[model samples]
Target: MSEISILKDFQKRQMLFMELYKKAFPAVARYISRKGGNYEEAKDIFQDALVIYYEKLISKSFSPINNEKAYILGIAKHLWIRKLGSNVINDTIESAESEAVFAEEHLRTDKLIYLLETAGKKCMDILRAFYYEKASITEIAQQFGYSGTRSATVQKYKCIEKIRETVKEKSLAYEDFIE
Candidate 1:
């Protein structure tokens, strides 16, 4: 299907979920409340369950094996248990947050991004399309009005080189950035 159709389907599903949310949330709240959990915690867990259910329903491999309400409730049960520190992989909420540990390269990447944005806009756009957005050479060529992929590839390399040079120059000018 086309992008518009996919988006429309998603919106339809979102609206459907609003109805499901009204139906499902009360049971989730009652379950949580019985366990001494607050309303906010119940809402958080139910939303995550809804997202999981939505992803599964939209996946290409999906089959109608179980009713949507029951499936979502099952997922919510697992999520609630995981929240309560019963699951090994998700013993605590902090454990999940800790998994996304920052890397040192991110700092250098930030500096490179700053230098690229300040240095040139067209080059920045092209490089972001190629690297950050992962656009194909043909797509990039078409977007930027290149003759073909070869020309786009060459321009991509030149942009990379320009950004690298700017990064080197900036690092040198600002001694704090060099090391």
Candidate 2:
């Protein structure tokens, strides 16, 4: 894509996101609040769901849907359930309960890593180079053949966003994985 087209696409996505935030956030917020989640948690889950929804919208595999708001809310509901489980949310849980939560989250992380490796090997390599190898931006740019540090930085952020979309897709793909 040309720079101009990329800019236009970004603008379009920004408008769509703003519209979704206005039309769908209130319903999702209320649902999360009723389920014992706070404002920040609701916001986080809603954003995650929105990213997933957007990915599905752009993909050719997505079928026609009547209600975009409902779809986004459904995704948010699943994310919340996966994060906190189906039972009641409690602030003062025992050590065992905390450990269980930790283990579940760890498993999710492992799954995400596996998916990244299989589905986005190049992105995984870029991320590992920047993060795990402690490579400098200039080094990354030279290795990846990016124009410069600025380009490398932008690519790094793009890879992160791609991973986010992948993770969201996985959460939706396996009913037992989340919820």
How does each model score on TM-score? 0.43, 0.45
lDDT top scorer = 2
Which clashing pairs does model 1 show?
none
Q: How would you encode candidate 1's per-residue C-alpha lDDT over 53-85 as one tens digit per residue? A: 767666777775334554565577678888888
Q: Give the lowest summed-lDDT range of ten residues in model 2.
A: 91-100
Which digits, one per residue and each the tens of the lDDT, describe model 2 over residues 1-179?
Answer: 53234324744544556567655666566667667887678778987888788667766677866656666777777788889767543322243234334433433434534766654767766776665345799998998899999999998888888766876766544323233
What is the RMSD, in Å, between candidate 2 and the native fold over all Cα?
15.8
Q: Which residue pairs in candidate 2 collide?
A: none
Candidate 1 accuracy as lDDT: 0.61
TM-score: model 2 vs. ground truth: 0.45
Give the worst 10-residue stretch by lDDT in candidate 1: 98-107
Off by over 4 Å in 2: 1-8, 87-179
- Please identify model 1 stretches exceeding 4 Å from their true place: 1-7, 88-179
